[model samples]
Target: MPDLSHPAAHRPGHGDPDWAAMRRILVVRPDNVGDVLMTGPVFRALRAAAPRAALDLLASPAGAAAASLLPQVDGVVTASVSWQQLDLVPGSDPDAELVGDLAARGYDAAIVLTSFSQSPWPAAEVARRAGVPVRVGLSKEFGGGLLTHWVPSPPDEEHQVDRMLGLLAAVGVPSRGIALEVRVPDDAATPLAVVGERYAVVAPGASCPSRRWPAERFAAVVRALAGDGLTVVVSGTERESDLVHAVAGDVGVPLAGGLGLADLASLLAGAEVVVANNSGGVHLADAVGAPVVELFAGTETVDQYRPRTTRAEVLTRPVSCAPCRQLVCPFGQECLAISPDEVVAAARRLRAVHV
Candidate 1:
């Protein structure tokens, strides 16, 4: 077989750093909401290792929303980069301006975080251009002198949270704990009070097509939950109003497009059980300690991004085409062919445990 190792152009020996001595540090995870949420433990570890150093995050527009909830993050710099191909949030800074902004912050060190499939070189380039002396990232590809420390990417099955923690370990910063976390603002409020105090949230939307189950199936689950004497609410972004409405129907309340990240966390925190696809909402719910029933899709392995929350259940079927990592499925989405009954059962089990 051809060498699968996309070795870096130059593999320098690890440049050990005394994290505590650093004055300011930047952690880069310019991905989506879910990706940033999974980096929670990495932030906690860095905070512990360099408690006196100011810790900031470089995030995409969506990622920035999740970053705000991370108590360990001191500041957030939002950017939509060309390499990531993320659509710019209106009024957000362009990637071209990133170097200048980062340079102004005078970060002592920068750590670029990416998933197994994503290369960290692009973000590392920005850090390098900004004159950050100690830049660290993981890469199996040619580095092109972008990173000062290039840690090897971990196995595909390693959980995202663990993979991030492992990167910190390579840089001599040990993890504080492997748990997802977010802080709901004390004053944050949700519209769910109208739906009654006891309610389940059914978030039927995912960032991509393949990861989402059919809306009608979600509606069936909503109806079943309502029959169980629990109020049901459907949640989503404003763009997903129609889907949320469809899933909620007459049996459930539709609370789409109204809440911000903090308010959404409040909504999730108050839920008896949250049912969602493999998306950011699930990660958000996990962070807020909500019971979750994850209707997982086969686009990625369950173990790779599984919820670390205690009262959670993942519902997915084995399919040969799983782990394809396709944004849109060309074949049957059999992996997410979970029945509504199965989802209802899992939700009920989580609710029972919570009680």
Candidate 2:
């Protein structure tokens, strides 16, 4: 039988950096909100380990908002490249501007974080060009000498939050607690009037279309949740309003437009349960300590993206073509084959457990 298990972190470095001497640090995680959120504990660990040092986050626009909400983060710089996410058209090259910004900041050391399947070299290359002498990242097959230390990462199946903390651990920064955290900034008041005191939030939009379950199924879930004496609210980015509306149908309350990132964080914090696709909402809900009913479509392995909360109930159907890593699913998309009934059941169970 094939051995299916988690991989351990491996370190291939000559010496550990002097954390005491490192004053200014840059954390490069130029992906989406979910990616940045998973890196939150790393930011916290760095602050705890180096209380005197200045920390700045280098992130994509999708990630910048969440980065600002982490109390450990001193500043956030936004730069989204074509390589970061799907549906972004060509010529999205913002590397030159990003590199100039990093070079100007004079970061003493830079740590490039990425998902298991992603290469950290591109961001690490920027750090190298910025004259950051101490660069750290996970070892990759085609790293191009972008990293000074190639640390061993845990198995690809591990939660992204734990994996990020593992990267810091390789450099001798132990984790405080492997929990996802987001500071609810006071500026984002709850979008209350329409929402009940206790409610379930359903986020039905994903950056990649293939990652979403069928819209009608999401509608069925919201309608069912409402029928079961739960107040259901549907949400997403302003760009996702159409998709969110399609999924909400008529039963769920639609707050899909106009809520800013911190506002969304506030909304999630007050939620009883978050029902969402395997998108940024999963990570956001986890960060807010909300129970998640995750309808995880296996465009990638659940190990990389599942919300890091025991309060979560993840529903997925594994297939050989899963972890296809393709933005567009070419297969029958059996990964999204889970029934709405399963999602509803999982939601009720998680809501009950968390309550």
| Whole-model lDDT per candidate | 0.87, 0.81
Top lDDT hit = 1
Residue pairs in collision within model 1: none
Q: All candidates' TM-scores? A: 0.93, 0.90
Relative to the unseen true structure, what is the C-alpha lDDT of residue 332 in candidate 1, on a scale of 0 to 100?
A: 76
Across residues 125-144, which tens digit of lDDT does each residue of candidate 2 receive?
A: 87887889888887546464
Which residue pairs overlap in candidate 2's backbone? 7-155, 9-152, 10-152
Error of 1 at 69 (Å): 0.6
For model 1, the superposed segments whose C-alpha errors exceed 4 Å read 1-14, 86-94
Q: Candidate 1, residue 177: CA error in Å?
A: 0.5
Model 1 C-alpha lDDT versus the unseen true structure: 0.87
| CA RMSD per model (angstroms) | 3.2, 3.7
